[model samples]
Target chain A: MRRLLPALIALALLTGLSLLVGATNLFDSPLDRSMVLAVSRLPRTMAAILAGAGLALAGVVIQQTMRNRLVEPGLTGTPEAAMIGLLGVTLLAPGAALLTKMSVAALSALLGTAGFFALSTRVPRRDPMLLPLVGLIYGGILGAAALFIAWSTDLVQFVGIWQTGDFSGVLRGRYELLWLIAALAGLLWLFTDRLTILGLGEDRARALGLNVRQTVLAGLTIVAIAVAVVVVTVGAMPFVGLVVPNIVSRLWGDNLRDNLGLVAVMGGGFVLASDVIGRLVRWPYEIPAATIFAIGGAAIFLWLLNHPKAHAHG
Target chain B: MIDIDHLTLERDGRVILDDISLRLPRGGITAIIGPNGAGKSTLLHCLAGLLAPRSGRVRVLGRDIHHIPARERARLLALLTQSPGTVPRLSVRDLVAFGRWPHHRGRPGPTDHALVAQALERFALTPLAARDVETLSGGQKQRAFVAMAYAQSTPWMLLDEPLSALDPKYIRDIMDRLRDLAPPRHGLTEAPAASRSVLLVLHDLQIAWRYADWFVCLKDGKLLAHGPRDTTVTADLLSALYDTPLRLERVSDSSVILPA
Candidate 1:
């Protein structure tokens, strides 16, 4: 409880600041103020928080199921697969409802994640670095395929918008699909113990009577839905997943049931802080949250690579 | 009690365990001793229901093991693999607590907590309970895993080379604990009526001879010999089993087998 207080406070402050920092002054015009808050500011704030929380939760599931810390939905080609699905749907039915696009994207993300899991089996476990490298190459191939399809269909600009995460475009109705992440987050919490047991390896988890295959598939599907929602709504939030969960696991340990709330709090706080900073850095203009996160996340990831503590287990 | 009837397992056109059958009775420590490629670990996996034999059946405590619900089967048997993978940043206590998963299924009660505590104390892991398993020494990590299996409170334990990579002291420590968990010898107070029946795949013949009450030897995925350890295990049998010349000699109260 003591540990959570400060994070909660920080999240509240960032959320408040995110709601107040846009172009329109909140106090100057009461009528337009509440309208702006309702239409754009409130939705943007919620989108950042939900996407962050969902991605972090997804990262935990992916890392635990694959037994690798470096792999996340982005690294495993999830967002790229989602992009391919979105492109396919757009080509097939350009006027499809937002929910239809999200469902198709989620299904493709699941398939892509499953493909990454299948490839992971052939990689030797001796080198911890090898698996992530394989994931990177796999993601690279999928990303290239998505790019080619986007080029052929003349949807390259649309693909570009989905590749970098930004909250500026988020509006009242446009961002509600990200609420699915709230449900996905609940689903992840329900399976926290199973996911933690999965990190102990398939044989040990089986010995403990966990249905390893079902638990893994469930986890991957949750990850897919969470990533798909984020991709469809706010674009790919690069290392928010990789960085947030790693940090939380480092400080709090890997007992998912115990640390999941913290992961969610810290993740929501991190992205909210990023969005607020993005608003402030250019004043009236804005930088994408993905760019800011990538800068900070890459530094943390590099430090994690060289950190002596990481070598203790691997 | 456990029964295997003509179990045969094949992987990618290669036979692992071929038409092998054996019965392991309840109580006491039963050691499966074999050379490399003897399917010792594979056989243990089959008994634990982690592997499905291509043909034949395995029955545990009167019910077909594979047919039993996974959670029910877990309650009946706990397997400690040779190389239990590490869950990063998991505390020793949390790792051991997972043994009770089948009992509570994620909602641990006070009884589960008490059992986890008892398991930690039994394995002398109370002092290190809060420590991350990843930071523990190899022997300590092995002890923690054994404690987890012990915490399962199952009637049967199937271990695959629990003593592998351990120093002599750790080996003796584990074997002694396993021996105590098995039914006591005459004049000694038995562990309990519900003491575990241990079946382990062993590479250390000396340790197996010292601690195991029953022995099952395998060679090339086939049953070589099995019976009471004192009768079935001999210099000639071991020599033929390993395809080498060896002799067993009594050294004071204990016996040691060596090259002839």
Candidate 2:
């Protein structure tokens, strides 16, 4: 809990700053101060926090389940699969309810993740870096397919919104689906021990009386739902999942049951800070949070690739 | 006692363990020795109920090993595979505590805590309990893993090459610990507390000769010899098992195997 103090403080300060630094200044504007906070500012901050936490949780789950720290929900074709589902729903029933669209996205994301897992087995195990490379290419193919479909159907603008993570359009009613991430995090808490066992690999997990198949399916399902919900509500944030869990795991170790809360807080803090920076960089004009995360995330990813010794087991 | 009757396992149209049968009496360290590709680890997996044989069965303490549920089997016997993959970034204490998982099934009780603490103390890992397992040296990590299996508190342990890459110091350290903790007790239906029968696959002949009380030799997936080490193991059998000329020699206080 003491380790969480710094993250909690940073998150609280970011939340305060997020509410204050909008186009309509709370102190000077004619708009009703309370209405803006309730409708836009509060929901935006909560959406960022929820999405960041959920992605980080998803990243850790997939990493443990796959026994590879280099992969994340973004690289595993999860968000791309969700995009395909959203495109299909939008084409079939443009006026479908948000819940229905989210359900479809979640289902497709699960299938996509499952497909990647199937592909992962065929990749040779001698090189740990190979799996993530395969995941990246797999995600790229799915993403290209989604882009092609969007172009043909004239849903390109909608795809852009889901591809780029921005908080400018968030309001109370628009972003509630991200709250599903909170519930997913709670569900993960229940299976923390099981997930830790999974990192030990199939034979050891089986020897320890863990039903490896069941635990892995449960973990991947949670990842799919979290990634899909975040994408449908606030668009895809690429490296929040990839970078945050790696950082936390390096700092506090991989005791999932003990560090779940810390991972969530740190994830929320990182993304919120990114969003705040994106907002401040151009003042009235805004940059997407995903853009800022990518710039930082790619650098960290490169460092991780170079420093494989830090992750080597024996 | 473990009763193996006509046990056979085939993988990808290749017979790994051909028709083989043996009764392994409980107590003492039983070493399964064989050359490369002799199906030693495969047989260990079958005994642990992690793999099912194509024909015949293995019975542990009169119950069909494969027929038992996973959790119940875990309680009955613990298995440690060769060079366990993916070093989880867990602390030494937490890794050892995982041994009590079968008993608690996620919610550990006082007994589990006591056993984990006892296991750490017995393995002399109290000083490193808070250290991440990944940071430990090879010997220390092997000891930590051994402690984990020890903490499982099962009546039987099946280990695949536990001393494969360890130095003589660690090998002797672990063998001595196991010997003192689970000395062979003859003709007893019930095992006393802290006593376990260990079955392991070994590649180091000298270490096996020094530590193992019984020998089970395999070659080309067929059992060649098995019984008390003094009676069943000979220089000729050792040579046949590895297809290399070897002689059993008395080296002062203990016997050692050397190429003839």
Off by over 4 Å in 1: A27-31, A304-314, B184-192
What is the TM-score (0 to 1) of candidate 1?
0.96
Query: Native contact fraction of candidate 2?
Result: 0.75
Give the alpha-carbon lDDT of every model.
Answer: 0.88, 0.88
User: How well does candidate 1 reproduce the true complex, by DockQ?
Assistant: 0.57
- Interface RMSD of predicted model 2: 4.7
Provide the TM-score of the second chain in candidate 2: 0.96
Interface DockQ per candidate: 0.57, 0.57
Clashes of each: 0, 0
- Residue-level lDDT of model 1, residues B38-128, one tens digit each, is 9999999999999998999999877888999999999999999877665468888999999999999999999999999999999999998
Candidate 1 residue A74 C-alpha distance from true site, Å: 0.5
* CAPRI-style grade of the A/B interface in model 2: medium
Residue lDDT tens for model 1, A1-314: 55678888989988888889987778886558888999999999999999999999999999999999888888999999999999999999999999999999999999999999999999999888898889889989999999999999899998999999999899999999998988888777789899888888889889889999999999999999999999999999988888998988876688887788878888888888788788889878888888888887788778875774632111
Candidate 2 chain A — worst ten consecutive residues by lDDT sum? A305-314
